[model samples]
Target: MSLLLSFGVLVLGFHHLQSIPDSWSQHYVFVKFGKEHTLECPLQGEGISWICPHNARSICSKASTRQKTLHLPNLSHKKSGLYTCTNALHQSYSTYLLIDEGQDLLNISCTSDSYTSSVLHCSMDKPFTGPSLLRVRSYSSNMTQEGKEMKIPQDENQNFLFDIQLPNSCPSEELMDPIQMSVEVMSSHEYTSRDLTFYRRDIVVPKTPENVTFTKEKIMWSNPSWTPYPSFFPLLFELTVRYRNNTIVTKRTEEQNYSAKDVQTIRVRCRDLYNPSSWSPWSPRLNVRA
Candidate 1:
């Protein structure tokens, strides 16, 4: 009977031990770029050592065996990885770290007139992160030419506006497309890396109407004098809008008196003014019946 009782007690004790919770539990998660963060891991036993993944560095908390915390600073992209905390009581926990790619403030606009300067504006939404470095790149589609990198300092909260001289040699009228602009932001901290974000706005140009059709004509004469044929009038359309990489042109015929047998074909094409070698497929030929 005593042996039976002892066996029962042992079994109960073992079951109770198995149900015990881990000694360590993660209390907080921290992530930051170009800065430091503190992580908290609570443990129940003494001699608790927290080891981080980067290099097996040890962080000690003397507050209590049941509680531990560590401070991580000067974080960068390379520091982004799994972090682990462990203690002598066989307690362990893990977490992940992420550094934001950061953010930038930028504005870009273009104009067609050759005499005026093209405007490029840039800024940083959060100047507290550090001094911001701005870079501008421009490209001409027609000439297949890329401009030099232009740099500026962005240390304030307000927008940074800068005037850029358009390429002195504009693409010939046939090849001149709107200029393309891109911006990149760099962290002031030498240890941190930066990324590029692009903002594109095209130049607004006038367009010629295409597919001119006449449903019917109004007549003032009392007699019914109508012909199945319509007249064709001379219509002129100019390429008004410009694109940084491409061009679009549209043409339409003017409304005029036409004989019943008149049929006109309309064709429109878009090409890169700078690089004459490249051109867009011509729009489908439109047939006008008069």
Candidate 2:
């Protein structure tokens, strides 16, 4: 992610501060996150001095002035906002200054895929600009469900990457939406927040079943410990059984008992219980005289 979002333009409907000329093309400066960005206040002529923005007690920030330019450093979320520059005449060239964590100042990205595996990938954008701590946590899109999160990977360089395993899909309504994650970058006086989502579709799959066992009159089975599919809860499996006569039966549970005398041939397969199910191929035919 890019640390710098936008520069040289007023954003989010913020109007310019009063006191500048109508023709001055540059009145706004936006800084990137995690590092220092400079803001220059150009004056038409001298005799007019530069005054920093302030209230009753302190200015928004203490800055270094060369002539008309102001130097600000290590910008983050809290450092962002408006700063006006006034001259001795009380007339101002109040440049609307804004600072934000760079495009991905936290220098991070996260994702999960059904084909690869069910895991969260997180990493820094690059080497460290300054010392900081990063923490990653997971939650459901809605506030109700949370706590199934992965850990942040550790690395030697300031730029680090790691993978955290995700839990198998839970069999509940809470798993319907995408999984949300918050990556917090913590420094002494500043912090950055980055959010990413793992779409539910990418972590979902009809995992292969456990050993399919057949007894004289009873059929029983279970599912694998986990599947690569995206899900917040265990998946519902729709089980199908084919009889010797080629008749078929599908059920929501994993087990079935046959009581008929002709229950000699059986083949079984399963599918995910969600809409437009992902069905598996029929199991090998099992024939026995009992």
Candidate 3:
């Protein structure tokens, strides 16, 4: 009888250890900043209790508690932390609560110089006052590029700029496939992330047209030197003509030459023929004689 009791005690201790979850293993819970959320303990018993985040017991006091659930009415950055739930048997579970603003607070813009260029330039237009960290990553069909985390210093104008280079050059052919991109901004108490999808052709900004000359009721210009395979990837040129009477006329065409009867000044710009989302900066104004 003594041996059986000892064996039964050993079995009970082993079962108790198995019931307890690892303290280091924490499940992540994401919630919007100003929304209400309820956390349910995994262990259901009579003596179940919750341990609030360190130094944040006051915030938990405002929460409503049921038998095994804790309901938080207003979620904020201060409420984000590790929450542990314990039962009568001393078994416990932990969860990390992460709260976000749930909106695109960064207002990030990313673009490439050319369709075939491997480098992408990204900028944040939002003006921030404090120190923060910025990270950007890109995912293509065959490649993934992870960006390096860098500290963002406070600037006078509050604008921040960064560059991301892909592992391979963009494909020349028109591809419908889009590259997935994500930008993450981390601060002392707040974290925000934004995801963007774009095609290479959509973000290509052609170089400004050059060598503009006007003669004999006709205006001619040289295409951008950086443009590759002029026939395969055609460019659409936009011509802006200002007359002596202060009247302005804009015309778009695939040809680099234009003919007009009267003009005082003429400027030209170009964009991708297929994808016309981005236009290059206007070329230098060429004075013309009537």
User: Top TM-score: which candidate number?
Assistant: 3
Superior by lDDT: candidate 2 or candidate 3: 3
For lDDT, candidate 1 versus 3, the one ahead is 3
Model 2, position 87: C-alpha lDDT score: 53
Cα lDDT of model 3 by residue, 1-290, tens digit:
22211111000000001011121121233456667766777675677778876545875565344347776667765565556677888887665554554445668778877766778888886423555556678877767896756677655756788888765644654375677887765443345678888888878888899899988888899888877777766889999999888899999998888888778999999998976669999998888765
- For model 3, give the 10-residue run with minimal summed lDDT: 9-18
TM-score of 3: 0.63
lDDT against true structure, model 1: 0.34
Misplaced by over 4 Å in model 1 are: 1-32, 42-51, 55-67, 86-93, 105-264, 267-290
Question: What stretches of model 2 exceed 4 Å from their correct place?
Answer: 1-132, 141-171, 186-193, 205-208, 212-221, 225-290
lDDT of 1 at 99: 46
- Candidate 1's residue-wise lDDT over 197-271, tens digit each? 221222312122333332343111110111111121112222222222334333322222222222244344332
In the order shown, the candidates' Cα RMSDs to the true structure are 22.1, 14.8, 12.2
Candidate 1's error at 271, in angstroms?
Answer: 20
Q: Against the hidden reference, what TM-scores do the models get?
A: 0.28, 0.32, 0.63
